[model samples]
Target: MTDFSGAAFYGLVARLDELIATRPGGADGFSPSARVRTHQNGGYRSAFRGRGMEFDEVRAYQPGDDIRTIDWRVTARTGRTHTKLFQEERERPVLILLDARTFMRFGTRDTFKSVLAAKAAAVLTWVSMEGGDRVGGAVVMPSGIVSHRPQRSRGRILGFVKAMAEATQNGFGAPPPRLEPTLAEAIGRLRQGSRPGTLVFLVSDFHDFDAAAARELNRLSLQCQVTNVFVFDALEAATPRGGHYPVSDGEAISSLNADSAAVRAAYAQRFAARRDAVEALSRQRGMAFIPLQTGDDPAILLHPERMQRTRSGVRGAA
Candidate 1:
């Protein structure tokens, strides 16, 4: 595995803010194959649910012009019949569903999964802004889920960056009085909250991703474009060099015997099983699946073409 532990492992708000200058390595327009559905005016052809609300410029009234669009004041001023022209808006709502559970805080290579998720989330948030798409996300905390509605503004995106930074650095802060929300619960919340045509990025390590989570995800896919970002560390794919290593459970520490080849093999198989299980739930090629390892440069790696070229290398490693 490629390890960059000495150089980088954790990232804070400043680090996330720095990612605003990030540029992806591909020309992967958001959901290239699917039609664009958004709120604000920008690129691609799009219309509001009921009618086109963005007004262009006024011109002389033409034949078959909508009577409601007639500009009475402009017509009276110019002593001519005039009508309003409405253009379609093109801005998609991008929602990032993040898993900030305790397990995501662990990593053995370059950075923790939580840090990686934050970095990647920052990159995506900036990219969406650049594309003129509104940005927001839902974070799965120990207490429950925190969600931000999509908005076409820089402040909203930064707020999202801030939330992720705190989540990774400070964590969800002491467990709730009741219980933490499961991945399924978080997904269910998103399913109910998200609107049609929104693009969703679900980032997680697939820990405790159960049938309930899959069902919720399937339902969510019907309305929004869902992409599964599978985050993992190098150690998860393989055991380290054979030796007696110290392990911890927060409450106590223990030593692990890694000398046995069978044990190492079993560990690798378990990782593969978990990965395959999540991949299966990703709905094949119909849904986007991104594999983000701990050592990856998320800004460049997230591009569709770059991801396509590197996918084999990522999956082939372990």
Candidate 2:
């Protein structure tokens, strides 16, 4: 509530709202590529720009129909000419899927991973809004999910922010954690309901990511445009500076010794494998993979080109 960030490790409603002012002023401004992928043309090489046009259906060719749009195969099969008709994509909403598991609340630097994710999501929302797009999101938590349907209403936007703020701390104070639906199930729900042409930004540490989640993402990318934001704290990305550090998983307390080089190497390799899996998925889907650390500037989170100039590649991020 006081600054653009509330506390170093927590997020607040007012603080997240302040991120609207932090949107990048560059030409791109985090707007998704205007190209829309479709089954036609083998799902590649789009010609239209901005909102773009999508193939609607082939129909009986009329007298005034352009010969260029005629489907020759259909004409030969039915002995009647068919014409391809297209509809302009009118509304493509920006959807963000955020992970609010307990681990996201832990950080050793500028802000908590959860707070960083919230801020990044806020920036993305405003950026999309500036381009005249609808914005909405869902927060996946251990207790349950807090979801807001896509819309442009101010009230709905506020509700989305509220859900994320609560998510940073898991959920409302009273609910006990449950597995009614795990992260995989939550993603599956989104996969089933998300409309084609939706631009999805998934923000998560992805510590518990599994094959089921990957399957959902693979299917989801086939329809909607996806951008994966892999959020992490310094400690998670790298071994802490060769010292004894205390850590806990809510139920038990433990101390981590980073004095051994072998331990550090193993930790690095494990994080690297996790990070590579996410990055590979992004590459496979032809989408953006952004590795955001706790101390990185939230405004630059979406601009990988700019982020690259200033940030070095991390062997591990997550």
Candidate 3:
């Protein structure tokens, strides 16, 4: 049995290994709709053009060859202009952007929002790897951003998991920078590291999401397949009835009087509004959205059958 007792609420050490071990079951269990389509060979094709090309060889310049691909060094050495030939790459890259900020550390359910985000990311990473895609990610922490360039190697994935563990253990010692700027920076890093056909996952509680973040997301979606994995605690949507609850953000503590009917109603309303706003933004941008609750089992939540059923039920309600 895995020893989960050593895990801090948001830490990744105890859980990551177990999550990786579960990869043998394969990621096919997740909804196929949630599986990202890349320009690469294996899966679905994207509507967008300009798939990444891998250099094949240098040959004598062909009349119809694009001049941009000319091998200047070869031309200079042999006094013959040569053009580079490239074929479409066989695999696409998957980038997971995780939020480990102060707000994500709080949870009243089975685990912290940060931990859930990590689990979700881990599962996604393993799935991507199973699909023969390169996997990489960035962990956005209050301390700083920890990122890994996408690669197919198992070592890279292990490194990414280690980085997430370190970031979570550091905790939120200082107030993080404003959400918009931090998101901008993270997006910039993604833009720098990823290619056009990359599948990007943005995992967070979205406490800091706003117009600026939305703009960044839109920009990213234009270049890549973007998915927003919104992780939240069950208590956020519905507080426990008739009890006073204490909450702390490391620096200070506050008590919530959930006994009052009016307060409970207002609290639930706030959470509902936030969820609606996120869903609206996802629809506007044509991005996929998956909501994961802290109390839920990650494996069950990600199960394809369960996801399809939940979505069907939601559509029927509407």
Candidate 4:
């Protein structure tokens, strides 16, 4: 077992630079395997379609030209049949809402959930910026929220990353706000800062996810493309081999008895139920759900092919 000492718990700050350096592969800087799904016509499609359209240029009319786009003025001036061409607009902004509550500062594997969330957000920021999209996000801490309006500047994206690192190091200071209220506040900020077509990523362990919180997220999803990146530890999905384990939350220490088969089964069932509820809520509200375990590399979420293969294996086994 790894030590959960002072330095280990809040060491995410030192890793911020490394996290920001992660670059997903592709000309668009998006992972080839990963695809964000968007809800359109009650069906799912690739989320990053570059859907927005912008007029590119006017050219001589072609056989299949839509009559509606026949630039009458240009045709008259040039004495030729001319058509207006539009290209896919790719300036969509990506807003990443990172949950940095105290609950997220734990991990039994590679690193704390907070660190993983920060790393994921950093990867997203880099990918979005490299893809020519505006990148910004809010870091939701227990004490308050640190938000950066979406912008196309590289400095802005790096600033957001720096803010996350600072928040991780300083801790929330005051008592943490209630989960639902915090989510609501974060969502409100997102609503104010983001446009309708923006992509929003909610990265967190979602420790106190509830009906009201889900409702808030649903409201956000109605306006923008939302993806829930749920960060959790492997221990959350399964209990360790029969043993008495001790846990601490800084202020309080408790022992968990995983010796009994029934206890372990019940623990696993509870976690599964919570996970199911989150997944169901995401599906109900047309949001994409990505689950990241603490032990796994955060980059895996960006890799679509790897995720597809994992899903295929799971379905085959079932």
Task: Please report the candidate that would top lDDT against the real structure.
Answer: 1
The TM-scores of all predictions, comma-separated, are: 0.72, 0.75, 0.72, 0.73
How well does candidate 3 match the true structure in TM-score terms?
A: 0.72
Off by over 4 Å in 4: 1-14, 25-91, 172-181, 308-318
- Candidate 1 matches the true fold with a TM-score of 0.72
Q: Model 4: clashing residue pairs?
A: 33-304, 33-305, 34-304
Q: Write the per-residue lDDT of candidate 3 for residues 1-318, one digit (tens) a residue.
A: 333446453343325565565454744322234334443424544433222444556889879778988999999999999978655433457898978777787776677787777777777777777666778878888767877988778888787876765555454444655542276677667767877767788888888666777677778877777778778776787777778888775568999998998998888888777767777777887777777777666664355246543321122001
Candidates 1 and 4 compared by lDDT, better number: 1
Deviation in Å, model 2, residue 112 alpha carbon: 0.5
Q: Rank the candidates by TM-score, best first.
A: 2, 4, 1, 3
For 197-300, candidate 1 gives per-residue lDDT tens digits of: 67788888878777888788888877777888889987877777789888874557887678988888887888878788777767553567778888778774
Q: Tens digit of lDDT per residue, candidate 4, span 1-318?
A: 323234545544425565666656662544222342222111122343322254557889889778988899999999999988764433356899988778887777777788788888877877777666667878887667878988777777778888776666544344445542366677777777877767788888777777767777877888787878878877777788878998776667898888988888888888777777778888888777888777666777665345443421111000
Worst 10-residue lDDT window, candidate 3: 309-318
Of candidate 1, the 10-residue stretch with the lowest lDDT total is 4-13
> lDDT tens string, model 2, 55-93?
656889889778888989989999998988765544566
- When 1 and 3 are scored with lDDT, the better candidate is 1
| Model 2 clashing residue pairs (backbone) | none
Residue 149 of model 4: what lDDT? Answer: 84
- By lDDT, the better pick of 2 and 3 is 2
